[model samples]
Target: MMSVRDRLEEVFERLEKRASDERVYPKVYWAAARAAADAADERRRAGVTLGPLDGALVSVKDLLDVKGEPTLAGSRIFRDRVPAGEDADVVRRLRQAGAVIIGKTNMVEFAFSGIGLNPHFGTPGNAIDPKRIPGGSSSGAGVAVAEGTSDISIGSDTGGSVRIPAAFNGVVGFKPTAHRISLKGAFPLSYSLDSLGPLGRSVADCIAADAVMAGYGALVSTPYPLSGLRVGVPRGRLFSQTEALVADAFEASLRRLSALGARVSDCDLEDLLEQMREATSRASIASVEAAAIHSDWIETRAAEIDPRVQKWIALRLATTAADYIRMMRKRDELTRAMDRRLAPFDVVALPTIPIVAPLMAPLIADEKLYNKTDTLVLRNTTPINQFDLTAISLPIPDVPLPVGLMLVARHDQDRRLFEIALSVESALPH
Candidate 1:
């Protein structure tokens, strides 16, 4: 095995070798990362290891506060904000597990968009194709893992921010159940829906990182048996706009699982989806919560905000407290309904995003096109957040442009979701 120190050096060299515009990390902790790597290397020589995450190289989203640094959350407005006095909860946990913290990765402004473009900090392009958009708001975290700059990267997922990038970059991203990990010291986009997650080279990587962040210490999942496992495919509007390639890949995955003795079946939830839509018709929980978080800035420094993100936040300012309350209550009811609907399946599987990542240029040039594309990109993964379910996106093997096979489990069943994903990942043709 390579020494942790040597691995860190190689990652730093690879990052330094990249073109400036192609850089993934905006803020790097060179001294801290080096110190952590040395300590881990010393432990290895002494025949002692902290845990599974020990010596792992990790990158965090810019939204997470590292003591003495301002949390940018990928926006220019926070450039001069007061620096944090302590590391975010997740960052602290990562350090305690002997993980080497590399630095902060770029993301969409305010973590409000799924397109991953940051006008202030240049977007990190797709790992597979430089011209394509890397999925976001966890954009750089995805690229860092895919390109081997980080062994695993932490990201926030309110509406597929983590999974979208993981899918685009051909990596594994796991979003734990909401509130599974403390959000202390992290910038808030949606108090109601925001979740911290990990994107890594493989499912095991995510599993280890997740356990550390959740304060579970060293943890592992026993792969669920695929034989007789019930896999539900929610085939409805969520599957309607899937590109032919994505559709083909998803169907093939289902076939493979079935051949392995898994019971794969289509599960319809159109009526439940309709109810969720109606519940949030007044305003989305994310947007409404975001409106509150940015109420001051939206009123005074609206021009300083990303126009794309600001527009949506501004629109939600009109959501009266009554409407917000009504939405939340209804959402609570719908969450229960969704859980009941999902009870029959071991896991619900779907295409993470209905289409592969699109070229970045056109979307950036046309504002209207950008909005349309963003909506499409977020459509599939956002529902999991709304319903409070735990989900993971695994890259479909051998795809030209990466597509994700998303496996969703009932709320708070994060560990089980990982176990199921492990089985599915192993069964897939590598």
Candidate 2:
């Protein structure tokens, strides 16, 4: 059997070969991998113990700055942008933990769309079915991890960017508690909601990445058993739009959890939809913050951005000041309500993305289809942002395509959520 380092070298060679053929992203860098291998060898020579992620190949999303690499965020608008002087905070941490930074993966332009269609860089196809999308704006991040080209891939999730692609690619993806990890050097999507996370092949892999990013010494759990944990099932609109396959898979997941001795119960949040509506009614934090970040660029380089992204930004720019204020006020109220509601459960479960991955061709052609699918894709995941809660999307089995079962915990209960996830993941069918 090949060692992890040897396996990574093979993956790098294969990915470099594929890069020439597919043009999945704009560029690939092998220097980072070489550096990581060197460090791992040094540690071995000194007989120093290594972390679980030692020698693991990690991929960074294009939205983030890797030292000496341009932060494209998948747009031609920044084609001539200079390389970053330093690594993004998460990238620095990963390197320090003995993981190799492979290269910057592609994303939706400025991390905008759920469909992952990049007019500038060609979109990465789903690992399960190449004809369909891998989901975005963490598109290539998911592809890199799922294809075994990288052991873990870092992505920024404002809404469903991380989870959507992870679900589409049949991998484990985690969005840590908002603000849990530093965002320095990361290109902003939605400043208030953006979170740096990872996509990996297993829950342990995801946790390993999280430990590094969070600057935790180790992932020491209190060993909470699954038997008595209360898993809340939010009743109503959360599942109203789910397709039959997702519905069945989600139901089966609940049964599996129950069989593992979890106390699964229905949680009634009569105001859930109303609160979500109110929070997003006027100007969402994402829209307003995104508009703010791109205000100057939108004015000077309006024609340079992808038309769809430009239109979305324009809509945000057009919002009245009152709209922003109203949304902020309501967002606070909704956050409080969600906190109160989720207090009793260890984790609230929902589908990561209500619908499966859709083809990029049709969505790129028809704006309406794009909007509809985009909204549905981010619906479940976005609520966590609204409440400022920590959540994780675990992939479910027995589905033709990848689907995620979202586990949401109360505000600031991130560790608890991760612990619950570990237990639930152990009980999930392979």
Candidate 3:
């Protein structure tokens, strides 16, 4: 049996090996891990009680400000920028909980896409299938956790960046209610939609990380029980395009939940989807806010950006002020509609990604297919951001490729959602 110290050292060694490959990220800072481990050991020796994550090794998405590491956000344009003076708020919380910040992980440049391609820095390999994508812009962060290089990974989720990879890589990924966790030092993607969250191997692991990041006390021990829970299955377009494996796995999951005594019912919230599309038509919060954050850089370093990313930014820049205002107004309307529709169920359930992770080559070659798959991949997850709901993507068993079963709850019901998720997790086939 290995001690926590020994285990963490092993993780650090793995980080070194992965970083040395130079395929995951442009650079890694090992000194930070050493310093954190020493501090953790000192605290333990002094007889100080620690949090559940004490001494656990963790990875931060490169988009985040990790002191002394450049906030690349997966772009070469900011490669020369100086290191951060302070850790992002989430990083600070992890430190306070005694987790070691091992190294920065790669991401899609500026987190512009769900596909997780970084032509500049090689994309992280998916743990389940090397040839497949690891999912982005939290690409490498998910890999770090799935590959056992870290106990937890802090990544940003704006339109499923965190959940997409976690699902594709067969791990647990959680996105808390919007604004539940502070985003003080993380790079901006979409100020309105961007959220900081974690990827881990188990629901318990995700819950532990979330508690610390949210500044909430330790998670209360909640037994998995589904005696009276109402879980809505959003039928129709939401589940229309799921692959055979994913569809079968989801149906089996519902049967298991039924055996566990959950009240599973079909729900049609087609209105929610319509509202979301309408809200984002003129100028999405993601486009408008990200454009604002990168306007200066885009103007000066346009040529330095990835062609796909540059085009995305260009589209944002083309939007008029009226478009932005219209988008915001419609966003508010959509939020209210979602809240009303979701009120009947404890949590709504859906597949995390419509299709399994596609081959990397085709996605890169055909921009149309890439855009199409990207929208479908994020369709279920993005609605939570629009409604400011708390959600979690738990792995569905027996699926050919990793596919996640997502559960969503109303704002401020994060803990409740987690409790429900535990039951759902157990109900899925092993």
lDDT of every predicted structure (CA atoms): 0.92, 0.82, 0.82
When summed lDDT is taken over every stretch of 10 residues in candidate 1, the lowest stretch is: 14-23
| Model 3: residue 173 alpha-carbon error in angstroms | 0.4
lDDT of 2 by residue, 311-396 (tens): 88867888777877788777788888888888888888988888888776888789988888888888788877777888888889
Q: What does candidate 3's lDDT look like per residue over 31-117, in tens digits?
A: 667777777777778877578888887888888887766788888888798989998988888888888877788899999888888
Q: Which candidate achieves the best lDDT against the true structure?
A: 1
Relative to the unseen true structure, what is the Cα RMSD of model 1?
1.0
User: Model 3 clash pairs?
Assistant: none
Which portions of model 3 show Cα errors greater than 4 Å?
Answer: 16-20, 25-27, 42-47
After superposing candidate 2 on the true structure, give the runs of residues whose Cα lies further than 4 Å from its correct spot: 23-25
TM-score of each: 0.98, 0.95, 0.95
Give model 3 RMSD, 1 decimal: 1.8
The true-versus-predicted C-alpha distance at residue 246 of model 3, in Å, is 0.6
